[model samples]
Target: MMRVLLAVLFVSAGVMHFVIEPTFTAMVPPFLPAPRVLVWISGVAEIALGLATLAPRLRPYAGWGLVALLIAVFPANVYMVFDDTPAIDAPRWALWARLPIQALLVGWAIWATEATKLVRR
Candidate 1:
């Protein structure tokens, strides 16, 4: 199901933070203090929210959390595209693509967990 897929996506991404620590840490914007710490915290949050999405009662909250997380990390995506010396070795177009993908992920989290219904009430 789409919900399961979303959960897997997030959970896998979270695990990758630790598996590829340097890569994720590199994505942190230069302005942020303690980039490694921030990466760790966000990884844990992603894992928790991903698992929470599996519980019907928790799905809505997880959805909103994902939206917030996506927004919060957006600056890094922007930085990747614009920074003169990007930490990651990705191509410029690939980095640029991540921006819109973030939006799609937000929309997916909302739709998969039915977060909009909560907003309607």
Candidate 2:
């Protein structure tokens, strides 16, 4: 059931990437080239990866992929923290607060798909 919820969360988040394009665009760090391109690419990848997590055989790989995804996109999360006006209008502390939450997200992805079991064996 946790896996199901995480999969659904990814799918919804992936779709929201497009639905909230401007906001996503705003999150991109200025140093990166083609922010729009990266936004779309990440969205599509999220959808594919999210669906892959639904299959019993694919869950482990997809779970690790999500772990990577979270790490890869973390810089933007950091950037959003310092931005004078983050698109979501989150309070300053909330922006800073989200950083540690990423670790929890990584842990949840691992547990939901039982990725740790793969590593332990």
Candidate 3:
């Protein structure tokens, strides 16, 4: 199911935060203080929200949380693309691709959890 798939994607990404800490830490925008702490906190949030999506009662909140998380991290994606020295070794095009991909992920969370339906009630 799409919900399960989304959960897996997020959970995997959350785990990767710790597995490749440096890459994520580097992705933090310069204006932010304590990049390492922020990375760890976001990782925990991702894992929690990802698992929350599995519970029917929690799915809507999880979906909204994902949307917020995606938006919160948007600046980092931009930083990676525009920073004087690239954060990672990724190609410029690939970095650019991530911007739109964030929108897709937001849409996916909405569709997978039917969060909009909850709003209608």
When superposed on Cα atoms, how far off is each prediction in RMSD? Answer: 1.2, 1.4, 1.1
lDDT of 3 by residue, 1-121 (tens): 8999999999989998999999999999989999999999899889999999999999999999999999999999999999856449988998999999999999999999878877998
lDDT of 2 by residue, 1-121 (tens): 8888899988888998899988988988899999989999889878888898899888888999999999988999999987875476778898888899999989999988888767887
Clashes of each: 0, 0, 0
Q: Which residue pairs collide, candidate 2?
A: none
Winner by TM-score between candidate 3 and candidate 2: 3
Alpha-carbon TM-score of each model against the true structure: 0.94, 0.92, 0.95
Q: Which candidate is the best by TM-score?
A: 3
Candidate 2's C-alpha runs over 4 A off are none
Candidate 1 TM-score, C-alpha based: 0.94
lDDT values, one for every candidate: 0.92, 0.88, 0.92
Error of 2 at 100 (Å): 1.0
- Identify the leading candidate in terms of lDDT: 3
Task: Tell me the TM-score of model 3.
Answer: 0.95
